[model samples]
Target chain A: MNPSLHFRPLRPAVAADGATTLDLLITVRSPEHPPMQLKERPGLNLALVIDRSGSMAGSKLSHARKAARFLAGELTERDRLAIVTFDEEVNVLVPSQPVRDPLLFISAINTIHSGGCTALFDGWLAGATQVANQLDPAGLNRVLLLSDGQANEGLTDAEAIAAKVEGLTQRGISTSAFGLGSGFDEDLMGAMAAAGDGTLAQIESPKQLADLYASELQGLASTVGRKVSIGIRAKHGAELVDLLNDLPLTSAGNHQLPNLRYGQELSVGVRLQLPAWMPNQEIASVRLAWDSPDQEGRKTLIEQLTLPVKPEAELEGLEVDPEVAEQLALLRANRERRLAIEELDRGDLRAAMASIEAIDQRLKGLPQSDAITRERRLLAEKKELMTQDRNLSRKRLRRESLRSSLNVWESGDDNV
Target chain B: MADSLSLSTAASLGSDSLYGLEELLALAGERLGEEVTPRTVRLYATEGLIDRPGKDRRRAVYGQRHLLQLLLIRALARRGLSLTAIAPLVTCSDEELGQQLLQLEEPSPSAEQQEALSYLQSLQGERSLSSSPGSSASLLPLLGSPLSSSSASLSPQRSLSTRSAGRSNVASSRWHRFSLAPGVELHLSESASIPPAGKRREAWLARLLERLREQLESES
Candidate 1:
């Protein structure tokens, strides 16, 4: 077991007739007694699916090729890599093979040229197939897709694409999408990453592609856990509304948690609806489980808290955890920003402006972090653009929406 | 683009941000992420789910306040609250309204509800509503699908034991074990499981055992 990993629930005892909110802070504190380092890190089964559409003919294609070549250099012989490039038709440039020959891999990637329409769906499917063929049970399995255009050739529907990505996620194949330039569908890529249990990035300019790829690859190489699932067993009549960063969560029986990396703490804020319950009723119990690659075994970390139901009047005096309150405020602000951007996309400038103003007002009273400050500036800039110009750029809207919804600003990296 | 765009400014009201009913509906629809009709907006106004547009019915104009009100109403409506129940709450202070909104946000279902939904979906996919619940062997694949580990699924070496207080609470105590490696193994026990199945006693036993282990170490 990885003793460093810990699950702490910052739950408050609040009495409400309708609902209450809770937060679970998941942290990885280094243990006092560190374990011996293994001789070798866990292997990775990675598929690089690059789009070679005509839209990517110039800088985008070259930058992607450079990134692929650079990624090959970072992987060892133990890692398995598959390179699949797609235009109007999908082609396997290099099948899944051990990364023993970096020269061969780099040469193969360099041969890919931009042309024709984008077969994004088929390209991703082919890459996933390659990863599946060499699927490492104890290693990280991921399909990293880079697209510069929409899915014009096959599977054009965003929901259909997302569902397929989710299917692969269920089958233990994680996927992350990188949208290059303005033409690619940010919504589709965001949906894929969210459902695929991975992260999404918008490479707004071609120049940033290599750096983004490098950062993502670095994170992927350090993956400590796999198949991480958090199943919430809430007491009956108490429903959970949203998860971390205002991510939409349905009132379902079980939830599959996203993978976590070392040295980072992930916090999930759960909004629970409480029907009037009898005093001393058990509110909820959370179960945390994951597969440990280092231990080469399935590991379980459980932290279950039972809250007693209290009368609404009694709960009024109970103060919420200060940290929980702060996190909730940030999440609500982000959600409002997202909604505002969506309104902008729908051509309702007035509502979008209102949402932006609401976000600005909400942010005013919250604890400001670097991420929050950046978001506020971006929102302000966007608001100014909306006020001055009636014509809103789809690219800017898509990028802003993806950035807010995916919690990308929260990360230390300034450019994603 | 004209149909899609809200170009009409509230000229008489002297504020570009202010809007008429047609524009309000469009803005409300966009903010709510759903189609909000003029009639629905009027209904919301009449029921006080949202504030009335202006003092005069002949020349009414809605501004930022009305837009926010309708948006909040739309949000509350999404949370499964009827307009009548949401009306009084809409007029509260911002902080109070926020607190109420957080309170009204739907909670996630319990573990039992998720299992029932999954089971129903599986049955619907197989077109086997009346088919038998199958055996303990069928449960392994579902568990195995998520993890890339070899022994993550239930194997022959795995053992499930239970000690119940009564038929009503069959999962009062349960034990589960699976061999992780040569000498290492995972042992878990929990008091979590759904209620007894109607007729499929065998299936319930299998599912109960699965729940016990899963609950003991819920996935994150």
Candidate 2:
């Protein structure tokens, strides 16, 4: 057997940027010999933040209610859930109620009717507050926010909302943002998710809204893992360049650990190009650390992962293996290409075209077989889309449309 | 009076007095208290079995300790021991070292090691040697047997004369002809061995010698 087989990670390092640093305590057990069972069920605290603005009056509101009903049905009796809705004001439909009566919860969701302007910020703030008040540290604390319209009321500023969400996240309440319509700012949704240390997903059409909600809620109810964070710290003099937690880069920091919700496996991909003088020299070690719920309301650190940065030539020999390098390279290239497109959207067509051409050239150099070839074809299509000189909003939509058409998941081949 | 005169004449004869390969082998054999051959000494020297006295390969002068190690190696080989099995015995000195050596020499229960041992066992059978723990001790008696006795058929005096003739030819060759490439030689010794070949060989040798010189320059 390969010596590396024994080194299988019990708690795998979540990729954060391309420089993954994993920190988790692992309990190793052979698959052939099962160990004594730990806890059979983990306690959960989930808050549903629904948008009841005027825009969610028709099929959007119906989908939200149906989704909530589905979520109510999925929850176990031991799990706790709260329902909160907002128009110009926020309302708590169910105040940290146990999942004891499914019909009653379904009635509560059905009773919600959309009206008034969307106060998304107030809605999230109230839902975050409910979670902060009701969540047990031992249970999976999460705030699932679904919005179909823009934030038009109090504290509508994206940065301020992000700040508030960040506070909620620091308090151990992971928030997942679901945008039900294109009108809702994807950037804002992404920022809020980042602030709350959760994931941002878009349900572009009303038809897919219920299914997305069901899938996300069911995933949450499973609750196999909790308190997941992708911890990353660079070597001396090597500052963290950027970070994206299910969204594009919105904030800058030195060290970061994106908080994660239940069953929300944290995976980060990053890239760092060493100073030219540092060639053939090992930079520093990257470490990742995470904590998971142990019993009732307590959390335990699961693992502390470390990977050394080898010289460019020696990177292939890392114990973590070369797949990590390939993934990092792909992510970096994608990010560069995306940023170039963004620049082009801002009227820098020549620069954007150059970046696109560069990416095309790079793709040509890579192995021409497998899914990468398909990706290159899609990228070429995206470049053609950019050549149309579309407006920023149109360009973004077109780019997203092209990306969705590719049928490739955003993370990388690992998920595929 | 005649014997004394002959001895004086021999002492004055510098041509016969010069040391050669066979003479060197006899000197080594005498120091080791064993019959050593030029081939065995050369093999040991090439394999680094014997440590060179001086830093220079060209100027290296082999002597007693090297001859002793050669004798030990030959004795172990005769007893049907592999180089790997005898390596520890040659290097270790403590009483407990013998147990460690034995453990290393013994085949593990693993299938791979067992297979290797089986192959080695078959080869040992061709020489009619036993695989017993005390088999090495039997080599001493075998050294005095008929097989070894016949090895003395060649006159040692005649061997010495032939070797001396070869040495004279080598000595007369130009020093430049023996010049190794600059960076090719790893040793810092002024008298490093040069290759006896072409311009490409000289270029390669120069590169190695230069590399060695660079290391010395850096250290200084």
Candidate 3:
């Protein structure tokens, strides 16, 4: 059986104008009903990439090691694991091998000690290679890189490091990035995950590392869908502007989406400037194809939506659909959150406050009571943190911003 | 204005009749033997899976586009595809859809392909019956109206009455069919509290039909 995947392609029927660009939300959700528990899944080949730089020596390193122990204990004998620690150089403490006795790996992880300058890129590259060497095409192959300092030794640029991760992903190895403490480069970690087709997370404190690592592990082990890709071909006179928030879009084209897990609805908001059209004209065509656990061949589903060209007056009279409005509001809120962070970083407290207020206003207008209410409350708490401590505000913003842009559900809201 | 005038008088103007929501539901039952409700039709419209009624809420009028889309929705839903998957097809122009229909109607058969083609046809026959809520395959042949595959193109200008058979199944077994109005029907299972067939049953059925007609009129 092929992956039970379906596409919910949505766009406003009437655009504001021919020259104007409107947002399109293409969401992919597994068609399978909610199972009682994460069904028995295939094994995972995970490489743990840890930063052993001086900055990570104290609380960060201790928590990371604890997280490693928790991970080692969680895996079954069938799963394969690797541990690579780096500072000025990279060292494979435990090579890629089955988790027959996790204690052996945990003890090796305990022996790791902090050393010289940070070599972030080299560390991730070595870990990604290790995972790829034992790549299980049928199983999940991932590299979880945790860093608490900037790359000072080699390949320091974020784009360069992200490009390397992109190459690794193309070869069937994805890299998830975790930024620990304030010293780490949030931009680099976010870029790695966005380009490598994995989740990006910011650990504000060392204590949260264990829970975050456990959650990431749970997400990896419960994978129900893989190699999910969507291609969009706009008819003549239309341009596919962008997949907003720079989703894990591939260099292959802007069409591909990141892999999906059960209960995760990847919502990609696309902006397009469509040309004038007659009534019932096909504006665009979308093809979604995926490979499931039981499927030997890729299953493809194609859909073409017709957008009729109505007069501006008519469009104005038509009521804006509530769902469309809600999605647009979410996108707007995400944009403002990023803007607020940037303003705060520049020390323009007034500008940051304005952006935060905008997010609050946008969330209030959305229809989903539960989702909107929670988001509004989080925004208020985030504002209080911003004025209280700058470091804490920055950390909170980075974590929330990454999750917001990637559309990752909160801990308890995973199945919802 | 002329288009609206023609649409308002379409009932007497033959094939390209502008159907009310009720008329569309009745036609779905007559042609496909499927019990489609007005609510489902409204849903398809809201989801953009079917052409919406032209006028504002007060005097809404559904045309040939809506009729063609409703039928196509039913046809695609029977193939085990979700509505999200089929929503794109609702955007296809009549000409584009005609081409797809042409492709679906004709198959190139080589010696080796014959076996697979037969299997697919048999699967289609079986699936149309089992998939729908209360529809059955046996009653489809009762339409008896000979329809060519080409005659069923989704062109808005073409009347839907000429649509080819074998697209779906009809209602059967442990079922009761009632005529609530001209071209309108009510399909009920035997479990319904319908009186036995006699003078009391006749009176009960008449009253039931009258009440149904009144309800439909009020909603419209």
The TM-score each candidate achieves on chain A is 0.84, 0.71, 0.85
Report how far off residue B212 is in candidate 2 (Å): 99
List model 2 lDDT by residue over A1-416, tens digit each.
00001122212322222433332221121123112465544667788999887677778888788888888888877777778888765676665546766765786677788655666766765565555544566666788889976676544668867776665555566788877765677667766765665656666566665566666655554443333333344453444454422232323322334433332323345433333223233333443333444444423232323433333444334354334333333444556655674675587877777776786677676556555676566666666666563443333433342221111113222111
Candidate 3, A105-130: lDDT as tens digits: 77778887776557687688667656
Highest lDDT model number? 3
Q: Put down candidate 2 lDDT per residue, B1-220, tens digits, no spaces.
A: 5444434443443223323456556865674457877667667666665443322224333333443455556654543344543443344333333332232232334442343234334433532232222242332232122122332342324333343234222311211111012111111111435444567555755675475345445545
As for lDDT, the candidate ahead, 1 or 2, is 1
Q: List each candidate's DockQ score.
A: 0.01, 0.00, 0.00
Q: Lowest summed-lDDT stretch of 10 residues in model 2 chain B?
A: B171-180
- Is 1 or 2 the stronger prediction by TM-score? 1
* Chain B structural similarity (TM-score) per candidate: 0.38, 0.28, 0.40
- Model 3's i-RMS, to one decimal, reads 29.5
Q: What is the docking quality class of candidate 3?
A: incorrect
Docking class of 1: incorrect
